[model samples]
Target chain A: MKRGFNFSPGPGTLPLEVLEQAAEEMLDWCGTGMGVMEMSHRGKAFMSILNQAQDDLRELLMVPDNYKILFMQGGAVAENAIIPMNLLGYCAETPPIADYIVTGFWSDKSQKEARRYCNVNIAASSEGRHFTHLPRQEEWKLSQDPAYIHICTNETIHGVEYFWEPDLPGVGLPEVPLVADVSSHILSRPMDVSKFGVMYGGAQKNIGPSGMTFVIVREDLLDRALPICPSVFTWKTVAENNSMYNTPPTYAIYIAGLVFEWLKRNGGLKAMEKQNVAKAQLLYGYLDSSNFYCTFVEKDCRSRMNVPFFLHDDALNDKFFAGAESYGLLQLNGHSSVGGVRASIYNAMPLAGVQALVDYLRDFERIHG
Target chain B: MKRGFNFSPGPGTLPLEVLEQAAEEMLDWCGTGMGVMEMSHRGKAFMSILNQAQDDLRELLMVPDNYKILFMQGGAVAENAIIPMNLLGYCAETPPIADYIVTGFWSDKSQKEARRYCNVNIAASSEGRHFTHLPRQEEWKLSQDPAYIHICTNETIHGVEYFWEPDLPGVGLPEVPLVADVSSHILSRPMDVSKFGVMYGGAQKNIGPSGMTFVIVREDLLDRALPICPSVFTWKTVAENNSMYNTPPTYAIYIAGLVFEWLKRNGGLKAMEKQNVAKAQLLYGYLDSSNFYCTFVEKDCRSRMNVPFFLHDDALNDKFFAGAESYGLLQLNGHSSVGGVRASIYNAMPLAGVQALVDYLRDFERIHG
Candidate 1:
C-alpha cells in the first residue's frame, strides 16, 4: 500500500489481504510444511487445494452443473483461437461461420483469431466510429445458423461496457449462443449465468493473476472441437479432468481460490456491484460535469470499471500524469492507442481509492480546468 | 521447511531463501510502491524486471549471441506440437522425416506429438530394458537426412539420464541439428549451449513453478518454422519481441528471475552441480548398499536428478509411504507406472534434505531390511 492505488488495466491490483495470506502461507500451507508452488499438482495436499479451489470457484460463480470451468494459460488471447477451434464443430465442414460484435480491441482480436478457425461474420462493429461506443444490439447483422456470437461485454482499452446482456430470444436469434469477454469488468457486478453460452477472461484483471484464465462454458458445447485444437486448450478435455488435464497453474489457482474466498467473506457479487456502481458514478460524474475533461464513450455504454478521459489541453497530459503519480493514483495514463487518463476500478480496487482519484480530479480541475 | 525433504519429481521443492524473498516482496517490490503482479507488463518498472530476468537467465546459461530465449507456456506438452511446427520448415512441402530417440515418458510424448507434424522415425529405444537405461548412441538407427534428432536429456519419470552430450560431428551421418527436452534438469547444471539447436521444458520441475517453459534455440532455427505455426508461438517472433509477443507469464518470470539470481549467488551452475551430484550419490549409495530396496536403472544411465527405486516387498509400499510421511518426508511415492518410489533431487531440494532422506532410508532398512 506504499504506492498509490494502481489502476493498470489487466495484470492489475489484487486485494492486499490475498497477497498477505499468500505470503504468510508461502513457507507452509495449512501446516503442510511446503509452499503451494513446491507441491506436485497431483499430491494429496495440492490436490485438496486444487479441489477446494475448483469447488469454491464453482460456488462463487454458481456455475451450472452442466457447464465446465476450465483453468488455462496463454491468457484470453489464446482463447481467441481456442474458443473457435473448440466450438466451431457445431457447423458443417467446408468452412464454418461465427458471428462477432466488435466493441473494441479485445473483440477485434477475438474476431481476427476466429478468422483463423472459420469464416467470421462481423455482425456488428463500432470500429468505424473509432470504438468510442458499443453499437446498439439492433444494428447487428448476425449470420444465419452461425457457430456462435461473440462480444466483449467490457472493452478494457476503449472504456465502453454493455450494461445489458443481449436478449437473443427477444431479438429473434433464439438458437444462437452468445459468448462474452468480461476480462476488465467480470465479478465487479452481477452476471446472468444462464444467458450466455460461454464467458472467458484472463485472470489478470478482475480475477487473480496472469498465467490462468477462467472459462465457463455450457455443458452442451463441450463435445465438439476442431481436430486442430491443441489437446490442452479443448474445453471438454479440460472440463472432464476438472482443469487438471495438463498440469494446471497450481499457484495461480490457489491464489484465485483465496480471492474467491475473500470475495465471499466481503459479501459476494451483489455487495461488490454496489461498491462498483458508487465508485464508477463518482468518477464519471466528475468527468461529465467538467468541461476540461472529455470522455469519448456514450453515457449508456460507459464502462463502470474503466473511465478513459482526456484533459482538454493535450500538452498538459504529462503534467497531469506526473501530478497524479505524486498523489499516488498510479497508472492514470491512458492506453497508448487512446492517450489521456484511465482509472480501472476492478473488484480489488477499494471505493476510497476511487474517491481519492475523484478528489484529485476535482482539485486539479480547480487549478487547471 | 517442515517436510523431511520433498523429492517428488516436479512442481518440486524450491529454495527456502527464494520463497522468503518472494513472500516479503509479494505486495510491494523494491519499495517501488507496487507488487510485481500488479504492474502492467509494458510499464518501465515491469519491463526492467522482465529484461533483467531474461538477461540474468541468458547470462546464467551463457546463451550464445545467435540463440534466442523464449519464455513460453503449456510447458513441453504444447511444445510437443510447437517444436515441430517451428522446425518442419527446414523440410520440403512434404515435410522431412524426423528422428526420435525414446528414453522415457516425456520423450515418448514428444514422439507422439511429432507424428502430427512430420514422418517420425524412432532412432533408438531403451524401453526394451524397461527404461532403466539409455540406449548407446551406436545402437540408434537414425534416418538419413532427418530434419533433427530429438531427445530428452533428463527423463523425469523413468529416472534414466543422458549424462553425456553426443558429439554429432563424429557420428558419420548427416549433421542434423539436435533438439532436447531438458525440462527436469535445467538450471541444475551447466549445459553446452552451442551443442543444441533447440531445447525446451516445463518450468514446474527445476525452473520455478508450473506453466513457464524456457526454450533456448540457436538463431538459425528461428526462421525454419512451418507456416501453420501460431503467430504467438513462433520462436522468431517471440525472440524479436523479447518474449512479449504475449504477456509472457509475468509472475512466473519474476520468481524464476529470483531463482536465477539465487543460483548465481550460490556459486553458479558448476557449484550447484557438485552439490547435486553429492546429494544424488548419497541417496543412491544408501539404496545400493541395502537389500531392502533396489533401483532399477543401469549404473551408466541412472539419473543424477531423479532416483526411482522399489522396496523388496510390494506389500510394504503402503507402510513405507506412511512411515515416510510420519517422518515428514513428502511426495516420495513412485510413479504409478513403475509402482515403486522416486526421489527427485531437483536443484531446489537442498543437499541436507537429501542427506536426511538417505538417513531415513538407512534407518528404514535397519528395521525393514
Candidate 2:
C-alpha cells in the first residue's frame, strides 16, 4: 500500500521504510521477546537502543565532543520557558537580559516566555514586515553582557528561514552565546554545532515523533540553571544521567533511533540538504511562475522545509484544498494564524511527492486561474 | 510466537492485543492515508483519535465531570516540581505549606521537589519501617492549612500501596486538596476521582507507553500556577488547551487510547480489578505458603501491581533469576535500590503469566530448598 504525500507542518511525514521497520519490530525488538515499549529503560536491551541512538545522532550531525545530546519532553513550546530557566542564572546581571532575533511566531514566543525569568531584549525583528524575512545580525541592537542571543532558525508558520549562520564577532558583539530553536529544520541541512552554545529542536518535524525534544548543548552551558528550574528540565542533570534523568521516553527514543539510522543509510545531512533544496526550489518555482498563487516570505529568506503560499482568489482556496486532497496531497492547509496553504517537505518527503504536488498545483491553476 | 512472562516494574508489560493493533495501524489508521504518528495533532484524523481516547479513558475511570483529563509530557518525576509550581500559588500563606505522606521513593521525591517552591511537612512516613507499609491516616500529623496534601497511592519501587482513600475530614483537617501519584496502579481498580484534587501518572505502567503523563485535575484547581511555572507545565493552560498546549506525545496518547478501548471491550475497571485481585492473591498465596520465598512488604499494604519477594537464601538469588529467564520469565529482578525479585503484573499481564511464575517459583524452591 502506498502512503500519501503528507505535507503537514509538523508531526510531519516520516520515511515509509522506517515506519515499516518499526511495525515489523513492534511485537519483539531484536528477538528480545518483548516489545521495545515494554522494556525497562535501564535494561540492557533498551540501554543499547538508547546508546546506539545517541551515538548515531551525534555522528549524523557531527555534534562536537564538548556537547551533550539530551532526549527531552514537552516540545519546543516548553523549551521556550525551559531555555530561560536553565540559562538565566549564567549571566552576571542582576536580572539578566537575553537578546532575541524575532523572525516569526516561535521566536516571538521565546522572547515572551523569557520575560518571566529575565529582561528580554528584542535585538532585531521582522515583525513590522509581518515576519516576511529573517533579521540580519548586523541590524541587531544587542544588550551588553546578555545571557544569550536566541533565534528560531526556521519559522514553520510564516515560512521564513535563516540561510546564514550568525557571526557574533562580525556584528561587533562580544562573544555572547548563541542559542537556537531549530525545531523545524534541525536535520534538513548540516549545522555548525560549535557556532552556538545550545541547539535544540522538537523531533516531530524532520526527526521522528512528536513527544520527544532533542537538546544539543555545549558542556560549558551546563549547571547554570536557576534554583527554581525543575530537576527534570535542568540540562546538566539530564546530560549527567545520559538523558535518563527520569525514564527518558524510551519508545520515542527508539523511533528516533530508527530515524537517525535511516538518515545515515541515505547519506546523512549533506544529501538530505540537497533534496530539501531541490524540493523547495521546485515548489517555489511553480508558485513564482503562476500568477494564480503567491508566497509572502522574502525570496532570500524562504524556508526550504515549509512553503506557505496563498491563492490569488480567496474563493478558490477551498477548491484547491479539495483537489489537492483528491490527488493524495494531504494537510496542505496553512497554520490557522496565517491562512492559505503550506507544503512542508521534510527529510522523509520524496522528490516524487513534490513533483506530484506541482502537478496538482498546475492542474488546479488551469481550472481556476 | 508466545511472548515471555514479563514482570518489569514500570514500562513493564502491555496487552498483546494492543501491540498487534498498533502494528496493524502503523501504516494507516482507520483508512486515513497517514499513520497516527505522521498525522498533525490538529488534523481531523488525529483529533478523532485524541478525542476518542480521552472519552474512552474518562468512561473507563468514571472520572468526575468537574475533572479535566490532560495528556501531558515530562513523566511523573517532572510532575513533582510541576505540581508545586501549579498549586503553591493557590495557598493563602506567605510561603504555603504542603503536607506529604511519604510511603516510598516517589512521594519522598515529590516532597523534596516541592520544598523548592513551598514549605513541606512530612505529615506521615513509612521510611522508618523501610517503606514496608502504608502510613495510616490516623497517625498522620496534619498541618495547619497547607497548599495541598500529596501521596503516592502506589509505589513501584518498594511495592507498597494504599488500599484505602484518605479521609481528610476524619483526621480533623480542613478541605485541603489531596494529590496522589497513582502511576503504577491507576487503572488496576475503581477510583473515586472526587476524593482527590488531582491524580496524575506516567503512562509506562498500567496505561501505555512512556513520555506521556496523564493528569486528572479538578477544574477548580486549574489556574493557580506560580508565575515561575513554565507555561507548558501550567495545568490550567494545558487543561484550557485540551492537552494541545503543546503538540502532546501524539503516538503515546494514541496507544493509550487503544489501551482504553481494549479495557472497555473487556469489562472496564471493575472487571480489571477482579482479575488483578486474583493474580495478586495467586502469587502472594504461593509465597505465603512457602518458607522458601518471603515478601517484605506488609501483607495488607502489598501492591497488586508490583510484588517484590526475596529467596530464603541470598545465595540462590542469581540462580533463581537465571532459572526464571530460562523458563520464559523476563525482567523479574527488582529495582536496583531494592535487591530481590519483583513481579509487576499490571493490567496487561494475564493470569496464566502469574501462574507460570508460581510454577517457576515452586520449581526453584524444590531445587534449592
Q: Write the per-residue lDDT of candidate 2 for residues A178-223, one digit (tens) a residue.
A: 9999999988999888888899889999988999999999998896
The regions of model 1 sitting more than 4 angstroms off are A170-175, B1-3, B93-96, B172-175
Q: Each predicted complex: what DockQ?
A: 0.65, 0.80
Clash-forming residue pairs, model 2: none
For all predicted structures, in order, the TM-scores are: 0.97, 0.99
- All candidates: CA RMSD in angstroms? 1.7, 1.1
- Which lDDT value does model 1 have at A278? 92
Task: Please give, for residues A40-91, the per-residue lDDT of candidate 1 as tens digits.
Answer: 8988888887787778777777778877778888888878878887888877
